[model samples]
Target: MQEEEPRGWRPAVAALPAAAAALVYAWARWCFGGAAPPSPAVAVAGGAVLVLGASAAYALSVRGAGGLFGALFLALGLLSTVAATERTAARAETATCVVREVHAETEASFGEGGAEKTVYRLALDCPGGRPGELKDAPSPLSRGAEVRIAYDPRGRLSAVPAGAARPWKPALSALLLLALAAVLAAHRRRPQP
Candidate 1:
């Protein structure tokens, strides 16, 4: 005999993939945004963990009835990539600004210690006087030096050196979304009981 299902469980179940995807996205952003270690081993480990976590989430959600959880997670990933790519195209302007400050950056060195690697950031005078920072700042950059950078007026993200191409994120995301759509369509065309 089949036991009756509990009340109000499906909604939470449906949200699992979304929550997992969000966590993965945040982790990835942190890794690429220079807070995490920049070593190849660290990057590979992070990528492996993300894949395994997403797979686990899909398995838990799809074991019930519909197999749509995979598509939902994939869609969320694609959306994030698209959003990042959009900033490169819209409201980005090239301008020369005075370097107001220079900051030395490094990964969070916890228990492990041997040597420290350093990166640089240059703060610039933006339109509204709020100031924007440029990551991967050149070694020669110094306060009061004129530097050209690409900045978004809205300041959703930090500035970058001018003439950077951001094509990989959206391209990879589009490919994944297209593949998922094709697979879903094929699955739906099969006959049901």
Candidate 2:
């Protein structure tokens, strides 16, 4: 049975966009280079848990529903936060490393942009193979060419080009998420249309 509460809440729908984005990002990561490797069973299990948790929240809006939603929000929030931090660190850790490999990587366009842009995949040897540790990379990187790689000491392999960090990216993303959440919470207070 639906929980008795104010009618204007649509937090569930509000989360859909981010969830969808995450799903797409995950798919892209999994499908990188056409040599997609099987995700560990644990990842599937975790995804299942998230789904079940959301469903359970929808089903039982009693006392714990808010908590469940909060948990979900935290989960998504932390993921973005971590990614942002990792990227920042990676950029700061940029070091002069030889590009062991470079390959063309194609990514699908988002929104209505029905266009494809070419990107490159670079392999840099870091102190350790820590991922998600780069923010911006210097320009003109090529295979066998020495290029500056910014990476987090914690993550080395996930380093990208030096200028990849756009201050607006995370700022805009967080603002939108908060705005949507606020709108949904407000809607939840209104009678369901």
Candidate 3:
């Protein structure tokens, strides 16, 4: 009689390490307030850890859904980490700017406890004749009011009222990680063949 191969939850088990690494990376970036990009050494080390975790998961998983999950986790982890790092780094540069224009938009949400939300955007005349815009301004800005702006070295706007609030990048990353964990858990609980 032919023997059936043993079925295991290797894929789900494997995802944990990579997920944990991503969480740590997210936390570190948040701690720095996205003010500075991670040093090259830190970036390289983080990449290495992510790669190793994905590789291990890939090797241990089955050739179908398990492999797909491993790859998905790896890709998401890489994207989130790189995005957080780059965005934070870019925002490290700062300049004092004068508001030239302000625009506001109101949107209605349909989700549970739906409500109307307003977003304010600002156009600024920065020092040295540099033009900049602030998306999601924390408060309404008066035209000609002086304010601090964070930007990339390339002169692109990054943040308004520097360090006023933490960016949403980390929160999005955490949500993605949480969804991945839930999927992995469900996969692990499936009946083995």
Best by TM-score: 3
Clashing pairs in 1: none
Q: For residues 1-193, write the lDDT of model 2, one tens digit per residue.
A: 4446433345554554355445534533442212433454644465455544543443343224443454454345434533443334323555666666665656688869678756666666655554322223333366667655544453223566556654456545644653443344334432233
Per-residue lDDT of model 1, residues 143-188, tens digit only: 8988777765655455667766465776566456535533443333
Which scores better on TM-score, 2 or 3? 3
Each candidate's clash count: 0, 28, 0
Q: What is every candidate's alpha-carbon RMSD to the true fold? A: 12.0, 9.5, 7.1
Model 1 / residue 160 / CA error / Å: 2.6
Error of 3 at 53 (Å): 14
The 10-residue segment of model 3 with minimum total lDDT is: 182-191
> Residue-wise lDDT of candidate 3 within 1-193, one digit each (tens)?
4435445455455456456556556644543444554665675576666656654555354345654674566556555655555455536567899999999999899998999889999998887765478888888989999888766554333564677545367647845754564456345433354
Off by over 4 Å in 1: 1-69, 108-119, 126-131, 135-140, 177-193
122 Cα displacement, candidate 1 (Å): 1.7
Model 2: CA > 4 A from native:
1-82, 89-92, 125-140, 162-167, 189-193
**Where is model 3 more than 4 Å wrong at Cα?**
1-13, 16-87, 155-157, 165-192
The 10-residue segment with the lowest total lDDT in model 2: 131-140
Better candidate number, 1 or 2, judged by TM-score:
2
lDDT of all predictions: 0.57, 0.47, 0.61
Show the lowest summed lDDT stretch of 10 residues, model 1: 184-193
